[model samples]
Target chain A: MILENNFDLKRMASQVRRDIVRMVYECQSGHPGGSLGCTDYLVALYFKIMKHDPSFNMDGIGEDLFFLSNGHISPVFYSVLAHSGYYDKSELKTFRKLNSRLQGHPTTHEHLPGIRIASGSLGQGMSVAIGAALAKKMNKDQSLVFSLHGDGELQEGQNWEAAMFAPFNKVDNLISTIDVNGQQIDGPTDKVLGLLDLHEKFSAFGWDVMHADGNDMDGIVAALEEAKTRTGKGKPVMILMKTEMGKGVDYMEGSHKWHGTAPNEQQLVQALNQLEETYGDY
Target chain B: MKKYTYTESKDTRSGFGAGLLEAGRKNKEVVALCADLVGSLKMADFIKEFPDRFIQVGIAEANMICMAAGLTIGGKIPFTGTFANFSTGRVYDQIRQSVAYSNKNVKICASHAGLTLGEDGATHQILEDIGLMKMLPGMTVINPCDYNQTKAATIAIAEFEGPVYLRFGRPVVPVFTSPDQKFEIGKAWMVNEGADVSIFATGHMVWQAILAGEKLAEEGIDAEIINIHTIKPLDEKAVLKSAKKTGCVVTCEEHNRYGGLGESIAQLLSTNTPTPMEFVAVNDTFGESGTPEQLMKKYGLDSSNIVDAVKKVMKRK
Candidate 1:
């Protein structure tokens, strides 16, 4: 369902944010900050930007594919995938439970339809996305491959290896976006390890770089659509999506405290009050 | 006693290259990835024939492993080639998460395994690879004896779905196995039958065990020799049958005795059938810069070592 208007996208984003908080609150564990921050971007991609099938297949041959590299934000990924009709939204209740398809970090081990790879250890998703993109090119399928990564994940060396590989091989069918929320578990990414000028870094590595406000649904949708236009031009695309550490709920925005903390009863009530039950709770 | 002979000596890595090309020809879904050791891995021919299907990952084993996992998502069988050390220890987490845990159909082809990697020293040679890989659930570990067996195993794994660790070596060895042999994943090949003692061997050690069997026959000991190619699934039926007949066992491999084929056999026999056993493997220690022959001799992994181990285990029986 291609949601053209901003109203539907915003409503969906609100519902996704509600789902993210509630899922974390139910489990009493999970990263909610990045999930809430990346809600609009995921909403825009699954609803408006990407041409994907709800009836999922492991070999996503003719359809666009998305991989969640920063899998700690599985709250948003699970919510988006469930809302996109990949699985029952009721399954969202079993996020971190034993024998649940939704693992703490996103994984395909349970045969989850939307997840294509297991990703808890950072810096591996870029290579996986590139491989899928290359496979698509080999199969003569023009559909794009998209992936999301965290800015702190850039600390891992494998990402640099993949960053060097994609453009050199002319992997133009890939669009990788980094959630530059600047917050990690210990503290901000700049304090933990400064990621100096990501745009210049990616551009120097031979990628066509773009920037967008990840919190703005309209901006995210426009940037993703524009990224599709940059495809097949002989270089991979990189989007430095700037967003707050947490968005929507008061007292959680712009703070790294909620990065991996589940909301308590009072906090859950406060968050639910802020995010309207647009699509109803699962 | 059954006799074995070879017309020529060949490296197992070349067999992997040949098998890869044939596997690629047989199934177009088979793709090859190398981390800047194309020549060492002997993947030149496969790259030549299917340049489009080949990926040069340029000295990044982690990226190569994860990419291979990704390729499996779109129905492509990706074979990642690198040294045994780099393939396992360097990118263990990558293999664990992306390939093994995810259940991706990725073939991790590793060359230069064990002390047989020769003069590159301890850093390059990996002796604990089998233990590391076998520990992972759902991982199929194979260490073929010679060129022909490696080739057959390479082709066989393409048809079998799941993550596979195919460990081969650098130095040329006797090509005694048949070229047309069918490589079964968990089936053990009985080389010479005897009721005295069962000699279980893998990789380069299999040839040593054969030589030991010949020597033992001359001594009237009558050592039964079995080639255990697949280390993970481990032909338990063959092992139990051989152990039951022989009453004693000896395991030989070019790896640490702590976590190699010997430990797996010991675990099996301790529970089901109690039997006397001796291990002809490197004691828990790192290898040094030396010739393959020198390393094999100094590390107590030669035919003489196997013969000595057989004699020692026969006494326990």
Candidate 2:
């Protein structure tokens, strides 16, 4: 596992947020709200919590693997993957471009490093993560499979199906996290269709459910470390991470308007200015 | 005319069961997933032997499909077993995005395909599956003709990489193909050779094509019979050669005429051979509850139908 002392995670989180906004601004199309919201959690995992290799082998045997279920948040995922040294960080500029490896959504067909399955469709990542976890068990590999999903995406029935499966089959090596920003394309999750009590739903599905303040880097790190301890018992672990939509940027924070919208030239400058260039811009 | 006969009949789903068991024995990476249709899909033997490898997703076809796609990441060749209706139409998006577009090495083995899934009626029977599977890019769609062929195809796809849709059916059908025959994907098997008309059939229709060839020989109208099993990467060379010699073609399958083997053959002929053609398939209608025999006759998917189509296409020629 990589040590948190090697680099300042707060600085890295700021840089990741900058990458997210710039990616969406450059493309004029891409998801930014959820990507910004989930930045700190990803920074904590990739930089401190997870044991992974940046050389980027798809098989990912004997190494911790992560899958982004809500693939529209490609900006944050691509940035985190690049910053973690999976590929040349300059490739972040090509987000959503024709023939670029950085597709609008994460895909394996482009042969992108660090991505095993393509997941733009909501509620699919949990099942894939469970499958990988099952494979890890079959191979006797001790590493765990991690996946992130949008809480609004849990409204998809497939998540519940997979939710029931992981715990029943004793898939204890998997850790599934949900970005509970409570915002989707249509509106607030509660207004569109309330996901009443995620903790209860997951607990009823026989998972070891826990909550985290997703925007807080330390809290995410502590919660993830705690989740790791909960593994290998008998049930899968779920981190119900509560984050604000567009957490970093002042105007975009805690609103659904920026859920999928790109910032204008002036707004881009404003958003980027809010995030410190701790690691410099790509 | 070459003679073909069978002393016994067996369901194609049992062929899948036997084939899956053999695949599991041959490769440790071969895993099976079923969505509450273990007995129907004939995956019981596989589940019994390799209980750890088999995943019972319990009525969630979408989850089963995606999980199979995921398993492929760790070098596991996943075979998802369920009825054809739930396999193709029910979870098409998941299959398209996660399996097809993602290009995962997943074997979507489907049983009880088409109108032959009798007594269960239209809701259970999926006649449009062949079309649905074939349209996906990089998907290999194989509808094996009989028990032996289905078993052979099931075993063969485990060796071949990439996504495949193996369509088979319920009801006992004659096992004409050899059990030891090499099942090659995207290749046509020449059942019989003739000069007057070409009869290309798929799925459960190959036996009927052979029977039609025999009756056509008795009528002095020589008919070429070919089993076109793999539909997506069609045997273009074989199709063109036969269509050129016969100057007419008759495509048979237990599927809708709109997107079945007939349409594929029509596209092939229009592009390469431009041969006159007739279709012995369902014409845009859903199936009703009945015996497999009754459905075959009513839907014009029997040997008599093939013979009649051949005669009609010959007049066009």
For residues A125-222, what per-residue lDDT tens digits would candidate 2 score against the true structure?
Answer: 88888888888888889998889999899989999989989999999999999999999889999999999998998999899999999998778888
Q: Show pairs that collide, candidate 2.
A: none
Off by over 4 Å in 2: A1-3
Task: Quote the TM-score that chain A achieves in each candidate.
Answer: 0.99, 0.98
Candidate 2 C-alpha error for residue A7, in Å: 6.6
Cα lDDT for residue A48, model 1?
85
Error of 1 at B317 (Å): 1.5
Task: Judge candidate 1 against the unseen true structure and give its global Cα lDDT, from 0 to 1.
Answer: 0.95
Candidate 1 on A152-232: residue-level lDDT in tens?
Answer: 999999999999999999999999999999999889988999999999999999999999999998899889989999999
Expressed as tens digits, the lDDT of each residue in B1-317 for candidate 1 is: 79999999999999999999999999999999999999999999999999999999998999999999989888999999999999999999999999999999999999999999999999998999999999999999999999999999999999999999999999999999999999999999999999899999999999999999999889998889999999989999999999999999999999999888999999999999999999999999999999999999999999999999999989998
For each candidate, what is chain B's TM-score? 0.99, 0.99
Give the number of the best model, judged by TM-score: 1
DockQ of each: 0.87, 0.76
